[model samples]
Target: MIWTEINGKRGSIEIVSAIYIWIMKLPEAITHVTIYSDTCSGQNRNQYIAAFLLHLVHTHKTIKVIEQKYLESGNSFMEVDSMHSAIEKEKRFTEAYSIIDWKRIMQRARSNRHNKNVTPYNVTEFLYQDMIDVKALALMIIKNKTIAEDGETVHWFENKMSMI
Candidate 1:
């Protein structure tokens, strides 16, 4: 996908989540997957999500986890950081000022010359929804595995969950 500016607070997260979800939806026969992400917290979250999916695949004897990296090459790293900076500038402007005004400016700018098809929207949200779907699928896979192995209904009850 072509790089586009993201001005929202959770834009990076959304993009990562979307990609992870999309990858997880592929047929079970597909064995390997690679993800390219930037060195950022959002990217980290995506990696974690991808790892969980990989674990699910392994648990079902469907696929093997291969190499995954945030930076594939030096040029990719540069490109990713540059794109991130552009988005950061847009985010700063939006947060320090008015979002509506910033959105208008972004729309006008995109329409001007270098880019016309790109606009700042809730890309993160789209990705997030995809991640949610993937998570649900993974949960189902796990539940089925549990039932098959133990022949008993298993439920996940959370008493305490923390990121740290």
Candidate 2:
């Protein structure tokens, strides 16, 4: 997803919102979502995304559960990663004039003979500026907050961590 610098950095909200939107795009038959995420706390493992996922599972009728799994470092050799490696290798010595050019480079990378079993990855963008509703999201989190007996303690997101 391409957005100007003014919008926001690749932070928790952006990552969470993107995943939330992607979950919404899943077919109705898909009730459970098991997300395999990299161990980047700010982008993937933070409370914001955790809260959003919890909220989504609780509220979304079609989606009943979400399991966030983290892959070990340098272990999960994703096909998309191979495609990206090709792009990086090519762009390391080359230059991309624009976003459109970058997309072309990515498409070319997918078809590169060196990158095997790499399917065409289209650049499907979710315009964060228009898609994210900060107020609604904040409200969702607040609504889902589980109050402890002490009352001062309010909990959201994960209380327990599961590998699978």
Candidate 3:
């Protein structure tokens, strides 16, 4: 949902913003949200993401739960991994100096003969108005009440990134 800003850091802050934008665009019928990602503290499994998820659960009327599940290391060969491999294979031959170039490379990766039938990724550039920061709000939440300690439940926990 967000990319291209000069200072853009694809950490929890930016990720949470992108996710917020995506979730806002979800259909009305969608309530439960389930996210499956590798147990990486930098991306999916982080306190900022957890805080943003908890914020969504409380603020969004249609959202009931935003579940975060970390896949086990050796057993997590998801389809997305194949896509990443393809993208990396494609990138090895070229040089990308900007986010747009990377986006284009990713778009072209799935268009090869073998995976021509694969759906193209929708990599929209971020608009000026789309830049958002949930950090302060997250901090406010943490100050008010600590994040949930139970990571196994439907709710997003505030226990630390390692636990997530």
Candidate 4:
């Protein structure tokens, strides 16, 4: 588990940056990564994140396939929600006077739950890129499908640096 300052808009860039760091930290033996995310356009389901998914496959030779799955809009139960609930519960019982304090509380909560691996990150540490070119290429390659063709449901798939 990785904890970072909850500042800035939770947009595609932030989401992709977290994903990049997470994937880089994964063991090299793991090739296929499947991510489950709520279908939020401002965050995960967008051209920019899709471009980074392409970038991941391009940069990480160990990663062959990246699948981004979305649950129906009304479906409530999700792993991310569970993580949030855990953190919120911990926060209620712990006094966080500073960011470090909050970090400590989060780490303790994870440790208490047998989640030993935790990394603390600052917003500045997230690697950012101007994805204009990649987005253009992806758009050119994917001419048939519209971003909203499926309405509220989307199954985003990336392989061999190609987004489809």
Model 2: per-residue Cα lDDT over 1-164, one tens digit each: 54444565677777776776677789999987888776666677655666677677778989887888766667776565766787787676558886667776766665636457767556555454644554466576755445643675543233334221
Report the poorest 10 consecutive residues by lDDT, candidate 1.
155-164
Q: Worst lDDT window (10 residues) for model 2?
A: 155-164
Over 1-164, each residue of candidate 3 has an lDDT whose tens digit, in order, gives: 43766656777767776788788889989988887767666777655676788878888989888777677778768787887898898899779998878988887777745465677666767754565676777687665343334533433333222221
Clash numbers, per candidate: 2, 0, 0, 0
lDDT for model 4 comes to: 0.62
**Against the correct fold, how does model 4 do in TM-score?**
0.65
Candidate 4 residue 161 Cα shift, in angstroms, is 16
Question: Model 4, range 41-148, lDDT digits (tens) per residue?
Answer: 777776677767866787797998888877667866797676677678778988888667776766555563555465432323322342124445556555545444
Top-lDDT structure, candidate number:
3
lDDT of 1 by residue, 22-125 (tens): 66578988776655444444434333444355554466445565444554334455544555566555566454354455545444333435465665433222
Clashing pairs in 3: none
Highest TM-score among the candidates is held by which one?
3
User: Which regions of candidate 4 deviate over 4 angstroms?
Assistant: 1-7, 113-164
- Write down the lDDT of every candidate, Cα atoms only: 0.45, 0.64, 0.70, 0.62
- lDDT-sorted candidate list, best first: 3, 2, 4, 1
| Estimated TM-score for each candidate | 0.37, 0.70, 0.75, 0.65
lDDT of 1 at 93: 46
